[model samples]
Target chain A: MQPEIQPAPSPASLAREDDVLEAAVRWRAEGKAVALATVLETWGSAPRPVGSHLVIDDTGNFLGSVSGGCVEGAVVTEAMDVIDSGKPRTLEFGVADEAAWRVGLSCGGAIRVYVERID
Target chain B: MDLALLTALNTERAARRAAVVVTHLASGVQRLVRGEDITSDPLAGDIEAAVRAGRSGVAGEGEARVFLNVHVPPARMVVVGAVHISQALAPMARATGYDVTIVDPRTAFATAERFPDTPVIAEWPDKALPGLALDPFTAMVALTHDPKIDEPALEAALKAGCFYVGALGSRRTHAKRMERLAALGLPQAQLARIHAPIGLDIGAANPPEIAVAILGQVIGALRKPAPAREAAA
Candidate 1:
């Protein structure tokens, strides 16, 4: 049976930063080029939803995700390119992918991800 | 900023039920430069005083993107109908953690004499809804299918930005309602937001099943997908 789960205790505070927001803050603090990737849209059994967030540091340290492990590796590579070029970009991931099997993800949904270099 | 100041700002905000945030201005400048505190919970008092004291929001990070999300728990469901469906829906909605309210202008029907512990509003939606702090987190359903009662509440709900707005009716009835809403100057986009057909395509038949489907869709809309990685499930 697919176990029903509710969200965790939320790490529950803005003061006590979670890993993702913390990373976004830290990367910018350290003056390393970074980009924030937010999942703005999804369709057909997507692993995530609009406003789902990811923080990608210039060195490719990732903080959040838009899909079920089926897309971040590729997204990180793309993030690095964004960092180098200093341009915001969008990318999509799906099962029409050669990388799905390697990531061990359910390969059926497509998620649209937006990467913006937070200024 | 100092952690004490941050904690003070946030704790007050949480007590007042507001959204708080922290922002990094100019992308590279860490620590909240302006218009940010350590909480997504909004704050009160001299915002001007605070901003002058070097509390500026991130200059580059435009708009209010939800920063450290704190799931504020389930929204309340204020239903206005003692009809059969309301019976099935009220408890289920409550169980899913909605603070349920049932209203009916009919005293005999809306009597709290039966739904003990549930606040039975024996007034119309227009009367009762003025008190229901309808916000983006609220989920409202008008089960009466009566034009007089359901219409008022539905209008109040739609204008308030309720997260899930629903009305119980068939395609033909909803078509007319849509026209009425448009006449009232409700925009087409706002009307589109209401889940008129209500519930998933689960072939729901009777009241209880329909209630289940309605709540299910509500949950689905509220849900956020799990992170990209879950550490081997």
Candidate 2:
């Protein structure tokens, strides 16, 4: 169906399918293990939607995106770790909560994701 | 490795299972709120709260219902007709990350070239369907208007328990189609599952627009129910 954007292999962007495929394909071609993280749902003013996906390769290489460049780096790093360990991970991004504040969620919105390795 | 991920995706779409998604926010303009990286404990952190605060999607923008679908085995879309509409739809459908198969008996029309990246089956419906292992997670669409092709494929789809079974046609065409389906011994109640005039009434005319409408309806039906307390399991 009339793609949301024009053809000719558009540049990568968060919340784009090509971005994910691009990263995954690149990683596969380069002989790296890759893992995929998909956004299942978003609440408040989040950047992406439920079906948004992000992929990362074992060498820390990555493609596609799940947020407004707010958390791709961290997500990619996490994906690499998940692939290395062979464990599925569910990550979260959201508002301020007491205790520990390691990951900064700038949007004040919440996003849930499921991460699994893809070789 | 890829197959495992696809399987998970299929499970969620087929069973409509609910699960939370976690995102790690980055530093930027406006707000910069930090939260505990509580995903370490596997079952740690308040999933509902985290998802809500993150604004996983545009909050409550459009009337689009959001559900945390756990793709148990991954989802697949079986397109019974390798027509132009399928060409437009296959990639888009893949975007939402559904495995796609284009089925058509026309050798010339159902070639890998027509559907560049999809699995194109140049065999008849009966021959093609039996091999696909149709499951509840499967979604079948008959884009070809030929009764010879669509009828048997649809019968197989109904028996396989596909979540969404749609056919490309107009309201008038659907009425006539019902007659054929009835003659084939498919009950009216069973026939109701078929989205005869498939796709939302977007008033689309072209192939791409029509494909969009069809995919939209398919997405809506396949997505898990909204957070209506009553519907929650």
Q: lDDT tens digits, residues A1-105, model 2?
A: 885964354223222444454456556667878787877567788787775777777777666667777677778778877888977776777775431134656
What TM-score quantifies how close candidate 2 is to the native fold? Answer: 0.51
lDDT values, one for every candidate: 0.64, 0.68
Q: Using DockQ as the measure, which candidate wins?
A: 2
Task: Assess candidate 1 and give its lDDT.
Answer: 0.64
Interface RMSD of each: 10.2, 9.9
Off by over 4 Å in 1: A1-119, B1-74, B224-233
Model 1, residue B158: distance off in Å is: 1.2
DockQ of predictions, in order shown = 0.02, 0.15
**Against the true structure, whose TM-score is highest?**
2
